[model samples]
Target chain A: MVLILKKQVLRRLITIRSFSYDKWYKVESERQKRINKKAQDFVKDKSVFDLFKFVTKEGVSEFKKFVQEFKETDNKNYKPYLEHGDFDYLYKFNTKEDIENWLVSSDSGYKIGKTKASLNLTQQNTGLFSGYLSSDYDKPEKSKAIYTGYANISSLTEQKSFKRENRINIDQFNCFMLKIRGDGRTYMMVLNTPSKYTLTYTYMHMFPLYTRGGPYWQYVKIPFSKFFHASHGRISDKQYRFEGLDVKSIGITCMDGVEGPFSLEIDHIGVLKDNESTEHFAYETYKIPKYISNT
Target chain B: MARRLLTLNLQLTSLNALACRRLLSSASNDDKSLKKVEKTEEKILQKYLRKIRPKDEEEKEEEERKGPFKNYFEDEERNKSAIVFYEEYFDKNTKQKDRDNFMSALEAFRVTNPTKNLYLDFIYGALLKMKEYNAHTHLEAYRKLMEIFPIGPIKCLTKWQRDNMHFPRHQNCAIQILEQMERNGVILDEDFVRLTIKIFGDWTHVVRKAKRQLYWLPKFKNSNPYPIPSIEKLENMKDIEIAFAALERMCMSADNATRIEAYFTDDLEEKTKDNFESTWIVTAQSQKQAELLKDHKKSIPIFVEGPFITWIRSKMVEYFVMKTDPDPEIIEKIKQNENYDDLDQNFKNLHNMFNDPFRDEFSKNKKSDLSVHELTDGTIFALCCTGTGTKTSLFYWTKILEKQISELKDFIIVYKIKPKPSFLVDLDKLKNDFKENQQKSN
Candidate 1:
């Protein structure tokens, strides 16, 4: 009797679940149809005149209000710590020894046994930082071996010179544009930010170089907003904004797990003001939507 | 209406703020002086707004139906008005943006009204003007004009020559247009060829100009024999047939070769010779001999002659066999076969030869050294039928045969096949012969 009663309850629960699922399916289909109709209507009504008409009086007022709110929130919440008037050359690698004074080598082989990496400054055709990395997966414990070669800007030696009178103020500048050439490989641009605690984290932005037309020099701009907070090479949940952080050092790391020779040529690194720079955001994740829907 | 007024007020305030920022940034000073300057700027902006308010009111009162030019680009009748505006003032417009807009509008109109030849003359005139202007946008304008109204090569060449003669500063533009037309599959005519020879016949001048204008000719993989064939070299040819063959040998595509041949043939009163069989045989023989002497160190004297079609087929078969690293024993067996007529049987035998495990091992070992595609009997037979092989395979087997004969100290004798007499005779002759025979019987 108890088993039959339980069977009857199970049948009732199954019927209820199926009924709810059918209702949800009907709602989803209807929503999809509505969205399709909206898309068709949008395409049909599209014209150059409609674009002009969108820049109406109400649109202008709304834009002004948004800008006003943004400015107010920015001023109240986050104040920049460093302020520098002029954008001057903080580090220039014109001489051969400047490389040693500015950069320190770090490789994954230091921690792992089977990986190999090397970094050298060669002046054959042009002065360039050549890095080679090879990985061996035959290591006993590890399932996969990742070889990384990095040249980090030394904070201990360069911090005094950088902070003396030529500190980079993130509020005034739009981006740090680096003139570099690379064999088509993805590399990471790392920035170490000052923290109140002894243990500080680094902000990283990974970008790929496309020199398909041949290895030619190109300027890669890294905007302040593109950097994401990461502790010990792993991303953290707490996000770091560029408004109030003091940047201690900058570095380049090659860690795409592609075990082969890699080289990057750096010509000049300089900060450009917001008005002087053409590109505002280095990465698309920080891109602002150009259009806003009225409805 | 209230919302519109509020929007206008906000826009004015933002504009005032921007202007104040620019002024302050340019002349930043003490706070008190800055305040004084800001107040003066605000007063000036209000006065300016008041002055423009009367004009805005007048414009509102007029309430004229704004033409396409009023919005510049955004209007329902933009296409029509833009066409009219371009037709009227295209020559006078000096701005690059205006020219770009005119070309874009013209393209849009052309797409909508493809059959309308009414505006072609105006577009051509504008194209001429743009060529004279010689700006970076001229190429785009020329491309659009050509796409809309595809002129014949003769007329295009004439126009190019005239343009170059008139404005020597931008002669490269004319060459660029011609190159683009050629890329777009425009067949060159006799007049066009004559004009090109007349203009670019001076090899020295063409080479000098080519240094600056790299797009004048298509780039080839290796060193080109005649990058731009001079008229003197082409004039020595017997006919368009030889000229075309020469061009083809110089790595020109069949399409380009035929196009050039047609151009030269059009000017001649006599028709081009359709029967190039004898000439082709001679040319092929000489070419094969020259290639053998240049490439191979061993002196190999080759003699290749047959009916033109048969000769080409045999050459293809030879190339297909040579490309594969076939077994020497199998090749000897096939060559010594008595039945030359049974080609399909011979091919099957060749296919069966590869089934041996030793041959497979040989192929496997050679696969590492040979980067070319692995040879299969099916592919070889297909290549034989198609008469198409890699460029290096041209007459490859003929050279191999010559090398073998030279090494063996053997001479190959080939006999020409003679044509048989006709079987049909005249009916009148037959009747006369019958009458004569009857007389003889009497």
Candidate 2:
């Protein structure tokens, strides 16, 4: 047993290169490189005294946090910067700068998966959202369930706390409209509702965005009522109508698990007032069961 | 030294004599009792032999026994693997590890551990083992696994108990089973519902999950707009046929004039033939697109773009599109007509608009054909996903299109193919470099 243990120790000391570890190291080094670049940019614009002031400010904040035992920040007076405009266009990807309003993230940063989301310019000056989606990832050592391959671009959420969020009231509009051209891939349109409880238990709804693969843009108008209540990628047992008045933000997600290149060009996202058709909610919503009530 | 050795030998002999005398005295007192003691000793030796190497008779008897968990629980090595259907069941001589074997294993485990106390570990082990056995896809397997949980007296009686979930571990185990089934795209049924209610009680979280799946799963099961045939049907179909079906579904319109055709690469003229083996080219073009193609000016270049993916369920088909450059005049016309103000404004002046019927007729006359192919980027003439995404295969498609629309022959087609990966290009160079390095070493 002693000899076996000694062999194991020596084997561990050799540091065999593993795919997951190499990928994790690559991501870490890239992050470090970005930080260095940002530092260089900071130095280019500022004097040494300005750098000292910035460092001191950061140090003072850290000292304050230490003294206070790192309490929860109460930003009750923080105002959201995203403008509230006419319901004609909630999000318009007209220029390269418009990409900043949308945050892109995927499983690659967290796991040994490979995915990317970037802005490409189309001839129409529309933002072409393209990505290489891959589900092939290193499985965790002890886990039986493996999950990866999801790429998302979400509008920036403006919130001070779980209770307070920058919500736009689109109660008048019955349908959510988008003008987009895609390569016939299905995407999910996610609408966030303000969380009444903890952020861990988020309340959101999603519907499939089916794009017709062609040269022309397709105007898809999905009824707000068609959005189903789904939480953390699972459909909720208790069905509820989407609360349009308490809307927080919207997002687009591609997680079909088909590894290939995908592109979707967006002209704009708008809310339409459809007067001809009248449907409240697509799914049935009854009274909550007695068991859930007890909870 | 000799005297000391003799004295030690005498002492040893005296102790042996003393032990013999005590045994003789005991035997003289009760002869029958001494015989009985000897019989018991022989019986114990036989039992130890049986324990060391159990015969086929013993193993069969163990199988016949209803509750054989006592032996299984006592065995440390068997407990570590945690599979109730031991190596004997999955041996080379026995049946293969499949759905039936998996079901039988669950049945055997349930039959043995009737009054189950430490069943949570077994359930978890079975859950992980389901994937290895490839039984996760079967609804019947999930049903049988759920039936493993014992019912009746353990059922929750009160609302609070049910809400808090009586036997929370067991209920959670059942939930994980259902979640696994969902991940594998298995729909819950009436049998599943009955089992959930019977084992976990009606108001428990497990039952609620079942109800949710029942309500939602079927609603979206056939919800794919570009629906292909069922997965089983698609399995037997040729790749070209499946691709054509997906193309047909995507190009389906109310007009019913969309032409979908498949061409074989070998059928092409000898001058254009590129592959030794035949490949297929499936193309779809609507009447509107054909008309648009005819109206295109010959001076401008038409671009053949893509290798773009369109997922028809799990299958990813790559198709190319024939398109023209974005026309600014057409974009401006589209922009001018996108006014929602006219929709609401018409209702306000309903009487005035109705009084002048000629004005309404004029507006109706000016209305253009609404096609998804007409866009600011360009007008799409046709789309085709080939067996091989090569320029030659695409050329056959354009030739086919040319026969239908003669105007396509006059237009210059430009190919904008995405370049092959750098590694593929560098492989030959790397081979040469390796050869040079080997020569230098020599």
| Highest DockQ scorer | 2
Tell me the lDDT of model 1 at B357.
43
Q: Give the per-residue Cα lDDT of candidate 2 at A131.
A: 75
lDDT of 2 by residue, B277-330 (tens): 367888888888888888788899999987666666567777788898878877
lDDT of 2 at A269: 85
* Position A17, candidate 1: lDDT: 69
lDDT of 2 at B278: 61
Question: Could you say which candidate leads in lDDT?
Answer: 2
Across A1-295, the per-residue lDDT of candidate 2 in tens digits comes to 9857865774466457432333343466679999999999878777786768766876576566555533533442232332112235677887877777788888777765767666666666787777777766554333333446888888886543322355677775567879887766789999877567775356788999987664545678888888988777877756778757767778898887567777788888887556654788898866674427511
How closely does chain A match the true chain A in each prediction, as TM-score? 0.52, 0.65
Candidate 2 falls in which docking quality class? Answer: incorrect
Each predicted model: what fraction of the native A–B Cα contacts (within 8 Å) does it retain? 0.00, 0.24
Across A1-295, the per-residue lDDT of candidate 1 in tens digits comes to 9857865885588578664333343466679999999888887787645666666754576577667666787554553332221232445565666565565455543554333333345442223554444443223332233223343334233322112322334555655666665544446766666565665544443323222111224556555655655667654434545552366666666654444445566655666444443443422233222331110
TM-score of each: 0.26, 0.64
Q: What are the lDDT figures for the candidates, one per model?
A: 0.40, 0.69
For candidate 2, give the lDDT of residue A178.
Answer: 90
Worst 10 residues of 1 chain B by lDDT: B310-319
Q: Ten consecutive residues with minimal summed lDDT in candidate 1 chain A?
A: A207-216
